[model samples]
Target: MTAHFVDLLDDLRRRSLRMAQLVEEVVREACEAVFQADVEKAKRVVQRDNDVDAEEVEVESEVIRLLALYQPVGSDLRLLCTVLKVNNDLERIADCAVNVAERARHVDARTLAGPYEDLRQMGPIVVHMLHNAVKAYGSQVVDDAQRVLLEEDAVDALYGQIIRRLVAEASASPAKIAAFLDVLSVAKNLERIADHATNIAEDVVFVCTGEIVRHRMH
Candidate 1:
């Protein structure tokens, strides 16, 4: 690749990382919005979704332009592909964050503290997992990516526990059904965010090693 092309690729990667950071903040805000039942914070998250969407489109366009104009080979090409894939995942995570934030108005975290424990634990793990994935992508280090992958199982396990607890506990607490659904929705979105974070980590591994690690053992 030409020096100019390399410069452009580096710029694009940085742009993608900035987007990831924005998405990560949004996820944190979403968690706070719902857990604290702060309607205003949730609204801010919804507004920021527009910015994330616009950035995602811009990054994707740059990827396509580079692919057609420069036709990078080997690792350069792998990097372009990783940026594109990571961009998509980041956008999806933003959408999930929005979903979680929207559920804030219905949640009463204090009242639902019994069921909210696992979900509360789940949120920060997913956020840290996302942070690790973004850091790995920026550093292009397989070890950093593996850190993200390692946390996915913990998030998944917590999600499962939430589902089971909600199912078993909801029947007895019929009056709080609305709040229960809101809690479930938040848990589902958090689980999805973890999944997307894992996808980014898997892409990072692929970029660094030229090996696909999606469906197989880690």
Candidate 2:
């Protein structure tokens, strides 16, 4: 029974790592599509969302099977629960990537007068956060998880800068309104992706320390 349970836990961890890698690819390609103005990459991101959805369903099914078969208690139960929460976070991150890709497809590259820089800055931060959050989950390291949480502020600040730039551009050229708005939407999606990464970090903390840090549980 002990060996079987350990094997199940390992399988869950492996599945989570795979999910994390897929999400990272999604975010990376989405940003590449936007910044490079690569329509094909953007379309690929949109097309691949279904694959992430299917992976989510598969992971959930595996978790459910493990729960019913082992009826995990204590730490085992916590691990299973954390996997479910993180699974949701990863899926949502993929959705956000698709949103960014769609926005990229709408953006008129000719009208975009070099103001997509903020989105470029926002991309790496969120990507790093997602990568580190997954590392925290895989290694069960609280510090890595905490780092992901703390980096949220950086992304928020970048978003503010992006907003200020967009407002200035909108005032300067009303004709560019549609293009600027698309850029803004892309930045917003990246910010929300960072938020989901933070949620994953919080889940990692709970899985490790057995403390729910999501909200004030009073």
Candidate 3:
């Protein structure tokens, strides 16, 4: 790759990192909206989804353009590919935040105090996972990416616990089924966010080591 192409690639990587930061904020706001019952914060999260969607398209376009024009190989090609994949994952994470925010609009925090405590714990863990994933992507460090992978299991376990608790609670109080479903929606979205974060981390590992560590256990 030429010097000019290398500079452009660096710019694209920085742009993608900025988008990651924005998505992280959206997730944090969505969590606060739900846990604190802040309707305005939920609305802000929903509104920011539009911005994330537009940025996703722009980032993908730039990646394709770079590939066609520069025909980058080796690490340059891997970096472009990683940026494209991470861009898509970040957009999806934003959408998951919107889903959580939408559920926050209806879910009662008071009602979530008992059986939904697991979800409350899951939110911060998911956010932390995403933060580490973005950091790994920025630094292109295998260790940071591996750390994000380690946290995914904890989020999954908490999600499973929430599901079991909701099932039992719903069985006992059929009338509160709607609230239970709302709580479940939030948990599901949080779990999906964690999955997307893991995907980003996996891409980072691939970029750093040229090794595909996606589908194997751990």
Candidate No. with top TM-score: 3
Give the candidates in order of TM-score, highest first. 3, 1, 2
Q: Native-vs-model 1 lDDT?
A: 0.91
TM-score versus the correct structure, for each prediction: 0.96, 0.91, 0.98
RMSD of 3: 0.9
Candidate closer to the true structure by TM-score (higher is better), 1 or 2: 1
Q: Tell me the spans in candidate 3 whose CA falls farther than 4 Å from its real position.
A: none
Question: Regarding lDDT, does 1 or 3 come out ahead?
Answer: 3
Ranking by lDDT: 3, 1, 2
Each prediction's whole-model lDDT (CA): 0.91, 0.86, 0.92
Q: Which 10-residue window in model 3 sums to the lowest lDDT? A: 111-120
**Tens-digit lDDT string for candidate 2 (78-186):** 9999898889888999999998888767876554435566667788888998889888888888988898888998999999998998899799999978888888888
Global lDDT for candidate 2? Answer: 0.86
lDDT digits (tens) for residues 65-127 of candidate 1? 999999899999999999999999999999999999998877776854764688888878988
RMSD of 1: 1.2
Off by over 4 Å in 2: 109-113, 215-218
